[model samples]
Target: MRVASEMGGVGGTTVMLAQETGLARLVEALEGTAREIDVTFARAGSQLGEGLGLFEGLKERLTTLSTDLSGPEIARAGTTLSGLAGELRAINDGLLQETGVLQQLAAHSKDASQVLERLLEHMRLITILARSARIEAVSVQAAGRDFGDFTSEIVALTTQAQRTIQNCARDHDHLSALLGSALEAQRDFEGRYGQALSALAAKLEQTLVEVTGRQQRSVALTSDAATHSGKIAMAAGGAIIALQSGDSIRQQLEHAIKALRLLAAVTAGTGEGAALDAEARTAAGIVLRRLEAAQLEESARSLAQDADSIEAALALLAGDTAGLLDLVRSLYQGDGGRSGSFLADLEADLAEASDLLAKCDRARAGVDRVTSAMSTVLDTCQQTVAALAGTVSSIVLIGMNAGLRAARIGTGGRSLVVIAQELKFAADQVAADAAQLTPTFAQMQETSVGLKSGGRLDAAHFAALDQAMSESLAALRQTGDRLAATLDQLTREGGGFASVVAQARLSFSNAGAMSDLIASGAAELERSVAEAAMPDDPAAAAAAAQLIERQVWPNYTMVGERTIHQAIVGALLPAQAGAAAPVVVAAPAQDEADDFLF
Candidate 1:
């Protein structure tokens, strides 16, 4: 029985061991699956992180660009607006630069304009020479050869003047292009940079306000202590000592107040009517009034020299009050004295003014803080402008160097003459190009002006284009989806799927091609319209003669005309399976002898 028990136990142990091994295998499989899932999740997270990094980079780039453009836009707008005195100084700088360029151009124009003047003078001289030739029948002694030579010389001179005029025109065009590019770049820079600077300034102003608030509390506490000390000294009947103590206290309080005022001026939200400034002034005023009205003869005698302290406080308060009143007057566009009853209503007026002043000062200080921050941004913009100006200067110098080669050409030399001719030809081409570009520039200017003023046509056109595009795309997508659903239905049902697929494919292919054509043609159409009213190409004129020669005369005048009857006949001819025969119409005759031509 013991042997049997051992065998059973061993069997049970083997079974248990086998079960444990199976469980371990299952656990290993589950762990492998879990690890795979973890790896997948980790890969997805990494991909997301990379995408976010790219998005952040794009956002930073856009922000920087927006800032650069905004500054120039604001600068330009501020100059245009008389109310923005803040930007007047900046605007003046831009004006100075523009004026400098204009002065240079005007000077250059004076010299180059002489070419036209010379051309006219030479023409007059040629006319005189032509008249002299007409006056004489034959060779006029020694002057005949001279006249011929003079004519040739004058012609050459005239050609040189023409070439010079052409050069001047080319230069003018180049200058115009440079100026346009510069202005556009400047405007873009100003718009972006100004917005960024303004935002930064606002943030700085907020920071200043928090700093100033803490400082105000310190001043208030010091002034209160001085008041308490004076009150205690007066109660003790040591009038002389009390007055001397108060005098010292007042001076200390004044110094503290002044320090607070200086801090308030520097802080954001602490401007013309800052609460701190108003509170300081009010405290000083109260102390002065009480000291002046007090009946302390002994104290007065001892502190007689200290009277200046009280007077100083009063003066400071008065100055602040005057300043507050002036600010109010400026806002309302009126004189405070003209109100006539301001002093009579002093307490109410003072209280209201003090509150207003505090608010104004805070607001003004905030604006100042913002402006200061903006100045830094403007400095950066100026640096960028300087860089751009350098690039423009380089471009101008390169173009000028190219122009200088034409100036060295001598009249008699064939190579030099050809060079001069080519230069003049190139200059004429430049004039033509300018003439072509001027209308486009004018149109762009008009469009910009319209945008600024909010014109109706632009709004209407944009709205129409947007609506049309959206509607068309929606319709196309809906049709395609419907066709796809139809094909899916045909396939599932196993009924005529092949025919339906072929029809749908053909329809979509045609629709897509049409859509592409229309989209591509839109720009081409606009260009064609703009060019339609301009001069025709000389090359195309050659084709016109050929086309004219290919024309065939019809035996009947009616052959070219296609009326409703003709259309009906043509439509019926295929159905009838007959050759199309021209229908002849008889013309109305004034007389029976007139031959029929139709």
Candidate 2:
């Protein structure tokens, strides 16, 4: 009876020792797992919070970008490049018209050059006739004085003609040069602007399209990120709640440990050779059976269930954390060097187009200067030619007088009269050439008027547009930088969060494993206790069970533990129901539909 009372089974002494060691190990594992749960969850919560902060930074930056001029309005402003291109096309057309005028003027210049050549030839003939008349005077010595007077007047007229022709030639050459310069300037403007107009027009149009598309994509991406952030926040909340619930599992494990310790105390008794009495052993057996049946099984099941919840919650956290990371990466793909900055690129293209337009203006100004100077030169040449024609007429009158005077003089002076006739013919030719030159000059002057530009674009309008667009692009670039920074922060924080959540999930699994080992070991000990021999004295056992329940009641912190103890104590010591009564003032609802213990 004493041997049965000692360990409560045949050779139960050895079995009890083994189970005591197993219980110690189980308790150690449970303690470690519970402690690890706290640490892992703390880290998980902290990391998740940091990720949330990073996402908030993104939201704030996005809001600022939308509020500032850097947003879609900048794209709208950039679209004005197409209008500028239109203006450029118009300006280019004006240059083309003026170029046609210069070309026409070039044809008129050719005609005037021919007329000037004829006039120069007639002046040379007049000069030659004056020399010939002088030679005739030398041949006819009697008429030498008369011929000398005529030749001298002829010489003066020829000298004046030479001067007038030289001046007209110089003026024509200068006008021709002006025409060339204007044409050349127009060609340059046309070549550069034609290509630029096409390219800038196309590029600006394409850029506007791309910007609009990006704006739409940005809106969608921003919405997605916001939704993902909310999900992450929700997942983090669930994980934190699940982590908090793990504490209750720890409490349950603590109850199991306390029960095991009480079992040890009952078996160990108060001192050496002071083993527990027979009824006390029975009480210990009953306590083990009830603990395994109610508390250990429930604790084990709760552990499994709570651990799964923790794993699932943390797993969701990990998934969403990774999703957030990807979202951030997608947001900043512009920084990734694949797509490049949008507004900055548009700004560069705008600058190029602006520069082309400015060059076109500069070329137009150069043409204007050429045309003005050419008109002045054409007017001066016409006046000189008119004066030359009058001088040729005076020479013709003098030549006629010389011829008549020589004819009156006699046969010896007849040769001088012939020379005078030749001189008159040359003078008439000069008058004809001068008359042709007049119409040519007038025609050239009319064409020079056509060289004036049709009109010009308002330079100030474009200047202001460029300035506004530049400011908008700069602001947009700044916003893009801030967005990139936010994405980078999100990536870093989210990566850390993923790692922490994974670890937390792993820790929950580890705790579950420990709880399983504890439950299995507890089951073995409960069976050992149940199989242990009991004392024949039922009354002492009942009284001892009641005393044990009252003693260990303080160890039951959870209401479930108290309720389990209450039911078991009432059954084990039924007669003392009034004494044990209900430890719980209110019979709280049982959780055996039995997932989580409150």
Which one wins on TM-score? Answer: 2
lDDT tens readout by residue for model 2, 489-527: 555655555665666565555666766765776576666
Looking at model 2, residue 377 earns an lDDT score of: 84
lDDT of 2: 0.67
Off by over 4 Å in 2: 1-10, 46-58, 69-107, 130-158, 178-197, 212-226, 266-343, 350-369, 385-451, 454-598
Task: Give the whole-model CA lDDT for all candidates, comma-separated.
Answer: 0.31, 0.67
* Model 1 misplacement above 4 A: 1-146, 197-214, 218-598
* Per-prediction TM-score: 0.18, 0.70
Best by lDDT: 2
Task: Report RMSD (Å) for each prediction in the order shown.
Answer: 57.0, 6.3
Worst 10 residues of 2 by lDDT: 584-593
